[model samples]
Target: MVNKLEVAWTLATVALIAGVAAYSTVLLYHLDALPAHPDEYVDVIGHQWFWEFCYPQNVSKVGCFNATYDPTTGATTGGHLWAAPGSVVQVNITAADVIHSFNIPGLGIRLDAIPGRVNSIAFTVPQVAAGTSFLIQCTEFCGTYHGTMRADLVVT
Candidate 1:
C-alpha cells in the first residue's frame, strides 16, 4: 500500500510541474508578442469588406483625417498612413459588419477586426524607400468580395 501511494504522489507532482511550465511558457510568449508604447494610434474600421482608416492628431484633439491610398503611383493624396522607417505604429481595428482580418505580409502581422470591439496590433515600419508599397488584405471571410478587400501600405 505504501509503495502504491508513493507512485501516485510522484505522478501527481510531475503533472503539476508540467502544468506550471506550460503556463509560464504561454505567459512569456504573450508578453513578448504584445507591443510597447506606441508613437501613433490609427483607427481602422472594417466594413462588410472594406477598410477605412482614420488618423487622429492627438489625445485631446478631435480633428482627424481619413486615409485614402493610391495603388498606381504609390502616393497618398489626402491623408494616408505616413510613418518614418523603423517607427512603431499601433493600429486599433474595428468592424462594422462581420469579422475581418488585417494582414500585412510584409510586416508579418495579422489582427482581427470584430464588430463592436477594437483590437490593436503594433508593428515597426521596415527600412524601405519612400515609394515602397505593401499589400493589406483581409484574411477572414466576411462576404462576397472577401478576396477583393485589399489596400496598399505605402511607407514614407
Candidate 2:
C-alpha cells in the first residue's frame, strides 16, 4: 500500500541511522579497550629529569636512569624492563618533580604519574606480537626541556 519512493526513503534512513549507531559503538569500545595499568613493573618514580624503576622481587634495589628520545642511539646503561606476551603486568607510577605520563602506543598503555601519590595501570601484551617500543613523556608542563622526557619499552 506504500509508495515505492517512500519505502526506499524509509529504508535509506534506517540504514543511515544503523550505520551511525554501529560506528559510535565501535568508537566507544576502542576507547575503553585502551590499557588502564602499567605492565609487570611497580613503583616507577619520575623525577625532574630521570626515572627510577623498582622491581617487585627486589624492593631495595632501585634502578635510577635517564630516558632517551631516541632508543637506538640512546644510552643503554640502565636496566631494562622486559615482559613476556600474554602477561598481565601491573605498574605503580609516581613522580617526584612534575606530572608525567607512561605510554606505550603499541601496547595501548597510557597512565599518568602524579607527584606525592602513586598511579597504577595494568596491561596485557598480545601473543606472538611484533613487540612495541614506547617512551614516557611529560604530559604536564614542567620545567625547561620537558619535551626530552622519554623512555623505551619492548613488548615481547
**How well does model 2 score by local distance difference test?**
0.65
- In Å, residue 123's CA in model 2 sits off its true spot by 0.3
> Residue-wise lDDT of candidate 1 within 17-74, one digit each (tens)?
9999999999988855646677767788877655777767555424444444445665
Local error of candidate 1 at residue 124 (angstroms): 1.1
- What is the TM-score (0 to 1) of candidate 1? 0.70
Off by over 4 Å in 2: 1-39, 58-77, 128-132
Residue-level lDDT for 83 in candidate 1:
63
Query: What's each prediction's TM-score?
Result: 0.70, 0.59
Predictions in order: lDDT: 0.75, 0.65
What is every candidate's alpha-carbon RMSD to the true fold? Answer: 4.5, 5.8
Find the 10 residues in a row with the least total lDDT in model 2.
59-68
Per-residue CA lDDT of model 2 for 1-156, tens digit only, reads: 889999999999999999999999999887555365454565677776555667765445455444445446664335444456777667778888788776666667777888898777666656755555455455656677665566555555
